[model samples]
Target: MKVYDVEGFPNPARVRIALAEKGATDKVEFIPVDVMGGEHRTDAFKAKNPDAVVPCLELDDGSHISQCTAITEYIDGTFDGPLLTGKTPQERARISMMNLRAESGLLNAVGDYFHHATPGLGPDLETDQCAEWGNKRKDVATRTMAYLDSVLDENDFLAGDTFSMADITAFAGLAFADFAQIDIPANLTNLSAWRAKVSARPSVSG
Candidate 1:
């Protein structure tokens, strides 16, 4: 299998962390994509992933998978590791719910703030921006942080007691929040402590 992505980017980092947790990091070839140069928008690259995004997965059978959630699902199913998705229907539904909340409410929100409100990747790549919408999304990110903090107050992880893909998504979201200069509120102590604990995991610390 192969993964096309730029290292250190938020979405890509989520997949990388999932692979590391699965002990499958060494099993796949990593192909670096020149996203900053607009290579991802080219016809050739878009053929593999219509979304024109990074961290796309190419299977051994010549099929391709796009989007972090889909790629992580593939990884969790194929690799032998702790269940990152879930084992039961209830667990799966809960993890999926939390994962979506983290992706849309936090990660994507921070991304909008970075690309639209700020200079982002420069005028060349960020051709269109809406500061008003971006600022609004920034507020959404903050509120999601508080929501996750409250969730953490009741459980060790976002979905429940076990470490899962929801935790991975939220962790990467917070990392992006830092890069975008979006402050995690000082009063979100549960969120802060949860971040500290997740950071210590071998999957993230490495």
Candidate 2:
């Protein structure tokens, strides 16, 4: 399999985490996409995935897989090992729900901050309302982080005791926020503690 990857990005990092978890990191080819250089917007890249997103998993069978969750699910299903998804249908549903929960809270927050406050990606910065929206986005992101921290206080993993795709998504998504100047404040003690555990895992690096 060939993986179109990009560092310093949330979605791609989730794939990387899944690969690391599966001990399949070296099994696939990694092609780095320079997002800052607009490589993802090129016709060549778009031909692979019209969405022009990073972490495109091109299978050996000439198949392409987009979306971090879908890619991870495919890997967990096709490969034989400890499944990142749940064992039962109800468990799978719960895990999916948790993953979406993190998306609305953690992912949206970082996006609101990055696409609005950061340069090189904002569409237009000339409007006052845009500034107001940016501020609001930052607020949502911060509060979401806090809310997730509380939710995490009761469990080891996002979905349950065993590690699931939701945990992978949450860990990588939160890592992105940490890189974007959004410090994990002291109020989120559970999150800080959980982060320490996740970061210690070998997958967090590769």
Which pairs of residues have clashing backbones in candidate 1?
A: none
lDDT of 1 by residue, 1-206 (tens): 99999999999999999999999999999999999999999999999999999989999999999999999999999999898999999999999999999999999999999999999999889999999999999999999999999999999999999999999999999999999999899999999999999999999999
Work out the TM-score per prediction: 0.99, 0.90
Residue 110, candidate 2: C-alpha displacement in angstroms: 0.4
**Model 1's TM-score against the true structure:** 0.99
Which residue pairs overlap in candidate 2's backbone? none
- Per-residue error for 139 in candidate 2, Å, reads 1.8
Identify the runs in model 2 with alpha carbons over 4 angstroms from their true place: 120-129
